[model samples]
Target: MARCGSKACWFGLGMALGAVVGGACAMLVRTATQERVLRQRDAPMVPSDATADQALTVDATDVVEYRGFVIHVFCHALGMGRFKALCDIWESGAVVLEGGGPPTTHVTAEESRSAAIAWARQWVQRNG
Candidate 1:
C-alpha cells in the first residue's frame, strides 16, 4: 500500500513540474514575439512623393479617400482586452493628420473606423 501511494505522489509531482515548465516556455515565446513585432512597428516609415491617386493604391484595403485626403485606419493590439486605433491622414504623399483613440477595453474595430472617419472629416472641414 505504501509503495502504491509513493508512486502516485511521484507521478503528481512530475505532472506539476511539467505544467510549470510548459507555462514558462509559452510565456517566453509570447514575449519574444511581441518584442519583435514592436520593433517592426517602430521602424521609420519612408515618406512617399506619390500623388493622391498613387497613394490611394498603396493601401487599398484600409485606405479611404475623403476630401482629397487619404485616411488610413490601423488597429493595434494592446493586450489585456484593450485596443488602440490610429488614424493617419495623408495628402500629397505626406502625413497631414495623425490621430487615434486611447486604449479602450470595449471598442470594436468598426467603432474605431467610424471614429477615425468622423475625426478626419472634422479635420478636413476645419483645415481643408
Candidate 2:
C-alpha cells in the first residue's frame, strides 16, 4: 500500500464510469420508446367537438316517413343488403331518396320521384 499507482486502479475507475453512463442511456431509451408507443396506440376515442353527454348512436329510422315513396334511410352502420334495397328502389322508382354514407344507396330517378320528394320532405320536417 506504499504507492497504489497501478494499472488496475485506472481500469476499475473506467469500468465503473462506463457502467453508470450505459445504465443512464438505457433508461432514457426505454422511456422514449414507451412514450412513442403510447402516442401511436392511444388515439382519441370520441369526436373532437362532441361532448361527454352526446349519444354514440343515433338512428334516423325513428323519424323516417314511410309515405307513398316506401322510403328508406341507410345510416352509417346499415348493411350492404339494405343499401342495395335502397338503390333498387332508387333505380326502379327513380325518386329522390335522401341520405348517403360509406356504402349508402339513395333513391334514383326511376321508381317514384314524387314519392321520394314526399318522403324526404316529411322526413326533414319530422327529424329536423
Clashing pairs in 2: 90-108, 92-111, 93-110, 93-111, 93-112, 94-108, 94-109, 94-110, 94-111
Model 2 Cα lDDT, one tens digit per residue, 1-128: 44548899878878999999999999999999999988753232444455421321333232334434344532221222221112112333655544521222333322223343454555545554
Task: Give the lDDT of residue 101 in candidate 2.
Answer: 19
Q: Rate the local accuracy (lDDT) of all candidates.
A: 0.63, 0.43
| Model 1 C-alpha lDDT per residue in residues 47-82, reported as the tens digit of each score | 343342233233422668888988887754333333
Give the lDDT of residue 86 in candidate 1: 66
Model 2 TM-score, 2 decimals: 0.33
> Residue 44 in candidate 1 has what lDDT?
32
lDDT at residue 111 of model 1 (Cα atoms): 65
